[model samples]
Target: MFEVERHCGPTPRRLRETDLPDLVTLSTAAGWNQIEQDWLRLIRLVPEGCFGVELDGHIVATTTAICYGRDLAWIGMVLTHPAYRRRGLARALMEHALAWLDQQGVEWIGLDATEMGEPLYRSLGFEAEESIERWAAQAPGHIAGEVLPVGFEAELDEQAYGVSRRVLLEHLAAGGSYRIRNVGYALWRPGRLAYALGPCIARTPEAAERLIRACLACRPGENWFWDLLPANVAAVELARHYGFTPRRHLVRMWRPGRAMRPRPRFRNEWIYATAGFEYG
Candidate 1:
């Protein structure tokens, strides 16, 4: 068995641009799909809110907290190197990140908890909110229909996610955007292993399909990842229509702190595709 290097206990520190390589390596070792740029975005977006632990002079654990003002926030990217498993490093970083977000006075903190991490999250008081699934398929051969870009629906988005996600959505908007007037919007961005279609908010299946086709046309024949809430039958049907199959599952978990209980839940039925696991 490998052993921790002597006198090499690294405390929680702010993740920096310099830690990008180590971050990617740690996540890859865990069979995750995050890439270098993904980790860098988190670092630059909220360096102070990103925390990591080093072992043997390399980062082996990490956790990120993103705040949408004091009203809502999210904790994600909780990962640790395989060699360091069960040593409490991931737990420590989580506790640290949660404490930090708490200090920020964020009313609600949520995360998409993987099966392995659910028990720990339960101990920390994060109750199940809903089921999120990762669906995937090869890009459709032909664009199904005409889709229009009607610009961002910030007000609609606010109702969908319960908080304005314009900050995050704006950054990913460059990837691609599909929208329908008075209906919904969907975005497509490149991912480490495939293109991600998500944060999709649609009023109807037709609207969602319109947005989905626009994105698939942008990158034909490439792998696509769609994370959606199964509660919305339309979202699930749309995925199947596009040949997307359920690949992974996660529970949207939430913990309220320094605020009232029964935290306000987001409109999951409206979220056809998530921005990313790290994001939601």
Candidate 2:
């Protein structure tokens, strides 16, 4: 038995590295892949917005909202304890989190939900942006001439804050809001600039164009690839405009059951230059 509650506060002070095992248990129970690094990053970046419902002090249902550049807030990792479902804990946590994000002036919110979660998200006002896509390319020759006209600079070092911030903004343009973690990259090439997105203040389409221009300018003679949310209007349109085509699709899923009722509106917009394939 458990009590469903709404918690809106900073991350619990009692959290320790050892708590990861228990956290993983609940996350797995909810049908999510284990991602330890992501958990740590979320806690550090938005402790107050990360909420959980516990049964007799045992963490059960949980959700996190991570802030991106200017107008985006990414919500993810909505989990519920197996024994604690049918109690509405997931809905409590998610609604509270989204409400908090809305209060913070976040206009664009994003999340990849599991199939089971789709109904809840749709009810909560989260529409499906697109199915996710992925592709791979090798060597400079792979992306020789497919560049966009954004400025290109390599990370000075692994801990370079300047590079990390710029990359974050670029990512916001290409994909959607993304939480920053230690997803390390090659310091040498740092990948070529096939696109140029501006500071966070520009229109999404313009940011995307600059990103593509940057990619073209930097690579000049190679075949670069990008994976975007399947429903991203800008991405699908841009792909057609640039002669790119669909290669694959992925469906998201979650466990427990539906409690949320997010509305389905708004298409996801994607920029280039800083897409996922370039993460490596």
TM-score of every candidate relative to the true structure: 0.92, 0.50
TM-score of 2: 0.50
Worst 10 residues of 1 by lDDT: 1-10
Query: Across residues 142-243, which tens digit of lDDT does each residue of candidate 1 receive?
Result: 655575763556667888877777777777676678777667888877777888887788877777787888788888888999998899888899899889
> Candidate 2 — which residues are off by over 4 angstroms?
3-18, 133-280
Q: lDDT winner among the candidates?
A: 1
lDDT of 2 by residue, 158-269 (tens): 1222123443333333322211122222111222222211221112555554444444334444444555554556655665666666544444322111323332222233
> Global CA lDDT of candidate 1, please?
0.82
Error of 1 at 79 (Å): 0.4
Best by TM-score: 1
- Positional deviation of residue 192's Cα in model 1 after best superposition, in angstroms: 1.8
